[model samples]
Target: MSDPALVTIPARRGKAARVKQGQIVKVINTHGDQVVDTWAFNADDLNEFMSMEHTRPHIMKIMPAVGDAMLTNKRRPILTFIEDTSGGVHDTIISACDRYRYKFLGVEGYHDNCTDNLQAAMGELGLAAPETPCPLNLFMNIPVHADGSLSFEPPVSTAGSYVALRAEMDLVIAFSACPQDILPINGVGHLPTEAHFSVD
Candidate 1:
């Protein structure tokens, strides 16, 4: 049996872990109204990583439903959504936040971002942070207009809500407990919080 594990991903930070093929990884929004940026890498080949680009077209969806498969850049199933309890509001089009993003927006000085969280998570796995991929923004609310424009809005998730995925391949998963405070992604500059991740 796969040893069960749970890691508390502190708000505004991130975490990484490995899961065997067929194991489940549950991303819990311990506190509602936060976004969890997520990515996955094939344990045998980092280059063949999860791609929201491939996932969207492959599944023909921006918001995945229960039973949807998260495909890799190579068009392979890496994870499958087995269950969701947040009305399936996950976003597939937004890229993870990076330091330059804040700087460009005139936020002076070094600011922690999803990129930093991703790096921290990667370090735990002893892997280099490869070119960042667009992530599956769990519980994030990116409102799209009729004119095809996008705007950030408060998330729709509630505390204790969660999404569960089953690994299709041996996987290395990375998560960024998003630290976006701008646009109040997590309420007034991303007040960090702890989230639960468990394998069963």
Candidate 2:
């Protein structure tokens, strides 16, 4: 069969789709710098979503590598990393940026953030995320230092590089082309860009 059509996760926005067990979801770094905050939820139960804290100990790594299974809050495998051509750099510690984060950064008004983007994306599918668990920050580069500190750095992924994850269970996958222009997480240019994904 032909390849599935690409779905666009618009710049500074979010998108989500459903995938069946054993299917693969390929997320593309379309512009090279955009950080896609990704999450997976059990289609039969939204309460059990992918949990970074749970996954870290389960996989024994801060971030997943090829063959690592991302676990849910209940500690069940949800998605498995099958391929990665984006330098294998991702983040699992940082919480999704929210309106409160912008406020803390001194923004007087509203700011688009990953937390909101996630809900909006799911809302489009007539669903609601019970909670915003820490996401698998795709292509996000945050360096942990020897001093036990962390720094938000630009993504190392080049344009069109992608990661392929296979669904371990029938689930809904959500992604936010993170709208974090105030930090260098996306890039030193502080510009958010669009991303793409395909389920097969």
lDDT of each: 0.86, 0.94
The estimated TM-scores of all candidates read: 0.94, 0.97
Can you write out model 1's per-residue Cα lDDT over 36-106, one digit (the tens) per residue?
A: 99999998898888999899888886888899999999999999999999767889988989889988878
Per residue, candidate 2 scores C-alpha lDDT tens digits across 1-200 of 13458999999999999999999999999888889999999999999999999999998889789999999989999999999999999999999999999999999899999999999999999999999999999999998899989998999999889999999999999999999998898889768988999998
Estimate the overall C-alpha local distance difference test score of candidate 1.
0.86
Query: Between which residue pairs do clashes occur in model 1?
Result: 11-193, 181-189, 181-190
Clashes of 1: 3
